[model samples]
Target: MATTNLNIRTDKTIKEQADQIYSELGLSMTAAINMFLRATIRTNGIPFSLTLNEPNQTTIEAIEEGRRIARDPNVKGYHSIDELKAALDV
Candidate 1:
């Protein structure tokens, strides 16, 4: 099989970091790229997940509020599920 050269433009810092990682894995950059290309063709799409894992604004607000409540000494702390149920009068 004949292989052709592929050229791409990327940040110098990113290339350096990737080079270090590929070296650590005992692969050259070319081999790493070929692995990624083969995986993309086999999968018929991008090789891996490309989604945002960040929480939405509402979730961020709730997490912040929970942290504030945790630091507030006046907020009652429950030692067990029974105590929590009793606090809710359930």
Candidate 2:
């Protein structure tokens, strides 16, 4: 089999973390990177979707409010699924 050298640049902190993880997994950094490259080539793209978007603040606030409401001790509990559905008018 033919072999080639590949060069990549990444954040120092991230690289250090990856090195530690790979070492613990019993793989050298070069072997781990080569495995990733081989998988990418086989799939013709990244193995999974990569996103950098932040969560919507309004949606997060709504979820937090719902959690607070759910945790209220005085909140009424439904006796059955049917009762809960009826209470919600659903």
Give the residue spans of candidate 1 off by over 4 A: 56-90
**Candidate 1: clashing residue pairs, number:** 0
List candidate 2 stretches off by more than 4 Å: 52-90
Q: Which lDDT tens digits does candidate 1 get at residues 1-90?
A: 997889999999999999999999999999999999999999999999787999989999999999999999999899999999998999
How does each model score on TM-score?
Answer: 0.64, 0.57
Best by lDDT: 1
Tens digit of per-residue lDDT, candidate 2, span 1-90: 998787788999999999999999999999998899889999999977787776688988998998998899888988899999999999
Clashing pairs in 2: none
Screening candidate 1 with a backbone cut-off below 3 angstroms (N, C-alpha, C), the clashing residue pairs are none
